[model samples]
Target: MSSKVIHAIYTDDDLLMQAVKQTREANYHIEEVYTPFPVHGLDKAMGLAPTRLAITSFLYGLVGLSVAISMMNFIMIQDWPQDIGGKPSFSFLENLPAFVPIMFELTVFFAAHLMVITFYMRSKLWPFKQAENPDVRTTDDHFLMEVSVGKHNVKDMSKFLSDTGALEVNLINK
Candidate 1:
């Protein structure tokens, strides 16, 4: 069965937040919200679950640290032991202090690069992807809230959204 949706456009972020809260309180399902910039606390306002990107970043950093340690051990100790400034070329642990910079740099590099890749994959933001925003204005200076109209009265929803400071309300079928 085809479903109907209500698109509420708000000019202000504050008003959008208030509308989202009111909509949630009134038992409406918010499908999504598109804004020009990231709206602080908008996820919480929409009752979304917290993200787990930090955990992934930590894992990526650990991988990078492991690679750095192994690479440094192979190159410095096993492959060709170096005698810089007459330092002892004995153990990996003994020369770990010198590899601290490489370890730190690799950790940060992997964490940053992998986190960005993970974010892009999670958000389905691949290169050359078409924009999925319903309203072009939302890309510039508007905030759009998409409310699913499952068993909800469209007229009442439109009126309620307008009352909640929506500048415009439009119905879409899908």
Candidate 2:
């Protein structure tokens, strides 16, 4: 469904940041902000919750570690029973030195790959996905902030945004 939103454009990141804070203080609902580069503290200013990707990365690493241990135990201790070097004992701990490299590699591999996959999925940007950016200038040197206009006067919001250092404010329905 389409909704009415206000697109506030700013030439500088500092101006955009200040506009966001003022908009929030005035109890305006911000839809989104688009910028050419990452803005430090923007998420916090936008009141976004802390990300949980670190927890997922740790869990993925644990999974990789478990798989590595299980595979090494079955291969060298149970399935094939390799006798490389003088250590012919059928124990995983005894043959752990030989499997350390594999364990470390797998742990890092799983964490990196799964974290990337999780990021892409959570962002709703799967393969060949396209996002509808409201303003083209935002991809260059400009920053764009979208604010919802539900139950609020569009003209007043536009004026308020313009007064808060917005270079331009346009009403868009999307």
Candidate 3:
């Protein structure tokens, strides 16, 4: 199914951005970009939308809170009753101080665990899944540009890479 991937490596972020602009100007489709560090405005430059993970985390946190409150209510009121704190143990609203800790724990638990699960699912990643990085060096000190050449000559792409200050270029076959 034509699993052709090409990468161009640049030394500096400015040069990499120039290359990206040139690629856009020439109407080349970019597959992905890898940088050694987070670059501000890069997502906007690439026209990528913001992730909605925060919203998912909030919803999960709410679910956890509800579960914790329901469980506490059932245990303290219906299942067993004990009047140790000299407060109304049957009515949770009368003694919310004790239930606060459990509620907080549940909220944190749900936010962390569920958010991680959602991230993994959204990224299509699972345990023991091999990484899909184009170049191992890109994770360290290099900036990588992955582009797909369609209806364009490879020679032209090579020329473009050279003009964009690419120190190295390579093709990956999957």
Candidate 4:
């Protein structure tokens, strides 16, 4: 099935931000936004719900910390129990200072790596996936806001977007 989408092009990020706010106030459903660089607070301006990636990252870090603790306990306390430089490893708590570096490093490693994987998976991005960019200019120095045209006058929407500082507006059927 074919539907209509409006692509409003803006030259400035500030203009795009204002347009997004105004569009939301007018109750238009914004489909997507493409910008050359990250815009501050654009997600909130678009009324998008907060992401839960931070929670996932915290959980991953906890898992990493626990793994590090168990590994260090088994290695330095139970398995070998080395007596390096007279700093005996008889108890895990007494020798915890030696395990701090490994624990910190492993926690950071797991959090960063797992967060990357989770973000890519959640965004459905991977090698060989086709791009869905609507305009090439948006990758360079332009910003594009895609809004769905559902039961609204195309001319009015185009004019409204233009008045909101769009350099150009194009109607796409997909």
Ten residues in a row with the worst lDDT in model 4? 92-101
Kindly provide the TM-score of model 3 when superposed on the true structure, using C-alpha atoms.
Answer: 0.88
Runs with alpha carbons beyond 4 Å of true place in candidate 4:
none
Error of 2 at 162 (Å): 0.2
Q: What ranges in model 1 sit over 4 Å off?
A: none
Cα error, candidate 1, residue 96 (Å): 1.3
Q: Higher-lDDT candidate among 1 and 3?
A: 1
Q: How does candidate 4 score on lDDT?
A: 0.95
Residues 111-158 of candidate 3 have per-residue lDDT tens digits of 999999999999999999999877788788899998887667778897
Give TM-scores for every candidate, taking all chains together and pairing residue i with residue i: 0.96, 0.95, 0.88, 0.93
Off by over 4 Å in 3: none
For residue 158, what is the lDDT in candidate 2?
93
Task: Give the Cα RMSD of candidate 1.
Answer: 1.1
lDDT (0 to 1) per candidate? 0.95, 0.91, 0.86, 0.95
lDDT of 4 by residue, 1-174 (tens): 899999999999999999999999998999999999999999999999999999999999999999999999998899998889988999999988878999999999999899999999999999899988899998999999999999999999999999999998999998
* lDDT of model 4 at position 73: 94
Error of 1 at 76 (Å): 0.7
